[model samples]
Target: MKSSILLLAAAATLSAQIDRIEGERIRPHVKFLSSDLLEGRGVGARGGQLAAEYIAAQFAAAGLKPGGENGTYFQRVPLRSVEVEPGGALTATAGGKSISFKWLDDFVATSHTQEPTGQFDAEAVFVGHGIVAPEYQWDDYKGVDVKGKVVVLFTNEPPSTDANFFKGKALTYYGRWTYKYEEAARQGAVAAIIIHTTPTASYGWQVLRANGRAQPQVRRAAGEPALTLAAWVTTDAGAQLLGLAGRTVEEMLQASDKRGFKAMPLGKIHVAGKFNFKLQDIETVNVAGVVPGSDPKLSSEAVLYSAHWDHLGIGQPVNGDPIYNGAIDNATGCGLLIEMARAWSSMEPKPLRSGWFVAVAAEESGLLGSRYFADHPMLPAAQIAANLNFDSFSPYGRVKDAIMTGADRTSFFALVQSVAERHRLSIKPDGHPESGGYYRSDHYSFARVGIPAFSINMGGEYEGRPSDYAAQKAKEEGSTYHQPSDEYKASWDFSGMEQFARFGLALGIEIGNLEKIPPRVDAK
Candidate 1:
């Protein structure tokens, strides 16, 4: 009874401290970060570099030791920016007959290497959905050799109407473009192109066109040669190619949804394309800091917290405003991370395990910063306990709940739930699983390497209003998600953000004080 009372009192004190930090320190930092001068913290821009420097300075001011490799607080990530020359074309030929498709209107291609020039010519094979997962008992590459050939894949997994194939209504990693590219490389395919549709991809061709115009993030595969080419074709273009081979796109998609689908030939079609682009060698930094633990023996173990600081830099001006200020997209997250660090640093009894805070860059382009860190970690991957990632937080007032993106896959959810409940908050599952947001963020890089990592977003539920109404409002607010208008509003609420920070800090502290590392759940 006495111990319980002490625990209650300690909880109250921690809550009070969290409120103080959020109101006085965190709010101020967030305001500055989201200010107009940062120019939306765009990747590879002056504003982006300024944001990195500011984050590093904040880490230093916090008295946290530099956690970057080689006694530095910043890890320089090499990036190659490639701009596809205008008028690029893709042509298909068979039996001396040829057809050509224009860029954007018909096709798009980007290299995943530092090389500015690359070329490849191979037979084209339609590989249906191009997924091979034992769990799903599906193999789209069955009895097919795509070496030195272009493998065409349909976007998204099997139809939800089909119960036996994939998770009908849900998207598995197999459906993601990243997974398709990796699977093709593993299958020795020289090139791969995905057929895109608005409903299937959940975005318009404009999104692909925008991304294709930017330089892609890629890590050298050492001795392994980079895939010769990876590209995307419009739905109409894919259909045209299929028609030339005497097959229909609908037939291909239908076949792909079946259990025993096989790679089908597009009747010996030839594709040729030349990529011309100027490659700019640029370096971005990942800011890192570490807090040493109190226990001499267990201090070696580490927990990592990550948030991306880069956003869409200055872009097409909106009403003469050029900066794409990504306030909620990540400045809020960075603020939360800094505030948590301050709280942990001020603790009377330091944690038993160390903590590392990473503010990554180029997350807007791809998961470049975190991918670089994962590939070249300051510490061994095996010594890291887990990774907690924050992308954006709640700004529409406090909620009675929190949402865990990859909750069921890891034990970290339990700790998060416990902490949430302690603060009179409920833990909620992802409301939009179809978005596949779990695989879209930095935590995914860590999870790929067997690290139990998860990302948390503000819960969908909003109290003091109808739950349905609040959910609608949240979705509407998120629509301004990646736009220049994501600037911090005066009416924004920080109470929910404070609660989220407290939950994250408590979980980190608990993990730090534990004797055994938090193991990945069986499913993870």
Candidate 2:
């Protein structure tokens, strides 16, 4: 009798949420967003502006109220684009000998000072991995004072097979280059340089050279600590830098893996650099809209659903294609967000708490828009029930499972599991956790601020394909991810996206109606 009642309840809930979501309704949005005319939806570009306006219009059509600043559906995000100008130089001096490395060939760097030109000369300190995790009982900076020095470090943390140590091979935020720079600044370092290798960074030298040479960042707030220069040097450059101190990069790597390794200063080695910067100030927008709650007492509390709408604008062409049309990278996620907003707004009696749909900008530029929103939120961080993010989705038809990375780290796990089961979708573990995906997405911006957040994506288990289909699809997806070839196909499947959208909508409503907000579940 209990089993029968549970089945009936699940069916009822499914019927209510599925009433408004149409798989076909998502295609038009994806089609237009990924069109060549949008120029890849580049942040701070004219194409990015069009994308924001379209998202706001979709929200207005869905009966959502303006949830941005001053009764508008757009939240302004100020940004600065920085690129190293030509004729700049980086040199390492040791024992009356100086070695000057060529830009983009040996190293790449940009200034965070927002100044047109600057120079710094300081002694070099090698801090292995540059990580300081109290939980892991590891401190590379122990007994070392690196203030006003140039801290050179590797890209990844120590190797570990035990899950208790650094999450066991799965990269943590501490392993990310962004964290390395942040920690360096906090330690009063004038500049931070990461030694990059394809194995440690999970990418090739070309990727580092492409991104490090130019980048965009959120305008720094006053009083925030920052390094004057952030850089990445090739493995060869790193070897030469360390060789000047009579050490090998191989020896340093081996020592960095051991526990209790301490930082060391390079003997008589110093770095000096003066780089001119081409700086431009640009403004972007994060389109946000809200559906008010039905319950008066709970209406103040809120839940946020987010998907980034930015991609690499224009870059060097691959096979003569310059546009990085991010169809699957995020256009699909934005389409799902729009359709979900319409469905949530159509409910007769809305959830107890308000539902916010935010199509953030500049995610491809290191989650700048989402970071800005998290720092300057429309609602209090404490009152936020949860944040559910959508990034990339497979366009290869329906699947038997869904992947919700980091959901297990929150109190919403039980509800998420129940909803997936009710919707006949299995939950899958992260396939490539070593990639540090959790720290790479916009959801991490919210998670870092004490809010429960995770991204929703479809798993590889296609419902009706041959056994080897998953592997084949994985290879195919990798080739198109972040490429111009990721253009939208009218024949592409939206069934899986539509199914997960329903599941997300139902789960969010359940959370909103709960007696208390969801909280983070500390890892054991």
Candidate 3:
């Protein structure tokens, strides 16, 4: 009996030692990936490729098999980079008179295809709020066939005073710019331009320019007619365009938000100047590896873990520092990936289901890398069990909580909650759903395709702090989020990271060993 107790004590000590080593293993890799040498891991840059190779090397060292096609760790993603020529102009003609506006100052446009050039010479119609929600009994496209015409759209949903309309102040998927563009395409419209307002868009025109300037990603599919062009006009510019048609922007928006609104033609025609396109063909890669299950029967099933490895890359200097090191935004996430792989690799009996670690690129570019992977997955999407994604780790010391975004939408919540409770941490829903952060990350692409994917994040929220205070802390940290000042600071406390890594590993183990796959919440 005495010898058996000593053996048990020794086993526990060994387990603790392994955990400590796994924690240490992740730190160096995180430091290297986010170092100035990596140049923010920008897509299409050497640094981005370097980051991919680094992840592949770590995956290989973790004893995982290449899960990508052709027996390699990389799945090459074909991307087209189209930059719009500056100084392009849009001219609207009405009443036999015309008005012209310059790009950037008044509007912007780009294609989802690799077309070097395109044009739209169509009539203009105003579509109220541009939303068609059967549940809300609001159909802006009612009785309007906008085929081959330009459709103008208001930015957000209706006001709360109209109870029967769209969720008043709440922004739905219909309010998103992506939805606006898609709805226009579905209506067979030749072009779409969204009217931007500070309140509705949640940012200024400069922010629009900053986001719009980047090369957008579209799933590379053949024979699809990419929309000719899409643009966002400032409220002032929108008003000017409306004035050309003898109408006020305010009156139009008010009419738009009300129930039973109709699509009205502005009776104005616009001709945009020839757009010179700047095209660069580039390839970004997703790094992926697999650890086969020890059970031969269960090896066919796989669990996926993903974290984006790219940030803003090298950009405009902030405080004379040029590298957007992204130490927290994702470097820590990449670190956690490595640590999780190590923990699984060292398991005594290994896991029942195979594990895949995918370090994706271009997440900063709107989940492009993951989008490509989900569209062209190495394993069948159905065969995969679940996906766990990490973006940033809490920089605040240790936390008693693990915040799960999109929690109620899936049964994975229970799994995560169980693990959190075991670790003396609470599971809470994301506080800022209005930001659409759930749809903004890499996991969103997978979730859209019927794969159960979730993103777990650490919080600065303390036990006694109010939700507003916690949100402020998140904002303060996010201010340095995309800036060059994101370099890893020596003052960062790694204790919280240890708990985070352990929690992630435990969650993976539970999922890998589970008999049934977690299902999506029916309500969502």
Off by over 4 Å in 1: 23-28, 31-36, 93-102, 120-122, 134-137, 159-170, 236-249, 314-324, 474-478
- Among residues 3 or more apart in sequence or in different chains, the pairs in candidate 1 whose N, CA or C atoms overlap within 3 Å are 42-313, 160-168
The CA lDDT of each predicted structure is 0.77, 0.86, 0.76
Candidate 3 positional error at 273, Å = 4.4
Residue-level lDDT tens digits of model 2 in 271-379: 9989889888889999999999998989998889999999877665667987878898799999999999999999876888999999998887789999999999988
TM-scores for candidates 1 onward, in order: 0.87, 0.91, 0.84
Q: Give per-residue lDDT, candidate 3, residue 421.
A: 87
- Backbone collisions counted per model: 2, 0, 0
What's the lDDT for residue 524 in model 3? 32
* Candidate 1 structure quality by residue, lDDT tens digits, 1-524: 99999989977766655554563466776777888888878677778888888888888888888887678788988887766666566788888778898876677777655566667667889898888888777788888888888888887787664545465565767788878888888888877889887767877675565454555465465666455667888889888888778877778888887777889878989777667666776788899999898889788878888999988776545557767788988898999888887777777667788888999988877788998898888888877888889888867777777777775577666677776677677777676655567778888888877777888677766768686867577577655566667788777788778778877887777777778876676433
Tell me the lDDT of candidate 2. Answer: 0.86
Considering every candidate listed, which one attains the maximal lDDT? 2
